[model samples]
Target: MELRNDPQSHYALNACIDKYYGSKGLPCLPYGGVQIRTSVIDGQIHEDVYEKVYFVARKYFIKYSIPIDTKNCFAMLSFAIGPNYVPMTWLVTEENESKFRVDNTTEAVVHNLAMLDEYLAGRLI
Candidate 1:
């Protein structure tokens, strides 16, 4: 089933992303999921991060026997972390741009990317 179409699965994926991303005190279940924005300069880096995060999420889902399609889940994950599909103004202004880059480069983000790198490289699997 598509994660975006099923409310339960959508919330589950959102919670999984949020918890793994180290977001605290945020809504446990966001109906439409959360959006993480990035500046133009950091767009590629955040894309790479989301790729890693998707693989990590896939691994966890398989371990837990979650019956979600890989492609669909990855697409949903992309929408959640990618700077697209939201208001362009979210990343347009110079002030928000810097903050967006900073938010995307947090220590937690770096660590998740690194860990997923190892996992993908057959070291963490």
Candidate 2:
């Protein structure tokens, strides 16, 4: 999968998620203005393969916050094996209008990109 580093291009992430999971009709929640959800069926059949869908989703949302606010949003992507396996959830929030709080590492990368974009945009304008 291609990693997007541009904040303005966050629409790509939504497209990717829609292409992959939208057809499945998975359950999702609204978190920080982003729709968060999980895949019901395992995309791949492999042991010890930890899926990081939530983190990835959160990253994209938080990373592209300059164009929007990531607060007042809640979403989760859970993994389960026939009622077994622990599910994971990722949530994001903004302490203030400018600062974001995320619970995943991938989201951190996104946040940095957002800050960079905002800073650069400010300088350019």
Candidate 3:
């Protein structure tokens, strides 16, 4: 969760995340997830609208220790929003990309990576 989050909200969020990490052997953060970007116009990229996330900045790796249930299901919980923590059930994607999910009810398989780019922008599952 490479956070350069609001200073006012950073403390509690960090603490909650830390507690989860402590239980996970402190492997640090989960840095990879398929993100779906939707801010573009009709899925078309605008040169002027594109922005670099970090040219060179501090990276806050956010991670958690979640175990799958008896049904081989588990959700990734996030406390980055302070009190409004969010969770997304484990899903199977084409690449499996560690912790990536493609949410589409119309199709069972995920083909478009573009539709998954927003997760990097802090979109809830």
Q: Per-prediction TM-score, please?
A: 0.23, 0.24, 0.23
lDDT of each: 0.32, 0.32, 0.30
Check candidate 2 and list the clashing pairs: 30-74, 31-73, 31-74, 32-73, 32-74, 63-110
RMSD of candidate 1 to the truth, in angstroms, is 15.3
Show model 2 residue runs off by greater than 4 Å: 27-30, 33-125
> In model 3, which runs have C-alpha deviations exceeding 4 angstroms?
1-5, 30-125
Tens digit of lDDT per residue, candidate 2, span 41-69?
36753221112222233322221221111
lDDT score, candidate 1? 0.32
Q: In angstroms, how far off is 55's CA in candidate 1?
A: 16
Best-to-worst ranking by TM-score: 2, 1, 3
lDDT string for model 3 (15-65, tens) is 443344455444333234322222346887532211011111133332232
Query: Among all windows of ten consecutive residues in candidate 1, which has the lowest summed lDDT?
Result: 59-68
Candidate 3: the clashing residue pairs are: 1-62, 2-60, 35-116, 35-117, 35-118, 36-116, 36-117, 36-118, 37-117, 37-118
State the displacement of the C-alpha of residue 68, model 2, in Å, after optimal TM-score superposition: 20
Clash numbers, per candidate: 0, 6, 10
lDDT of 3 at 42: 85
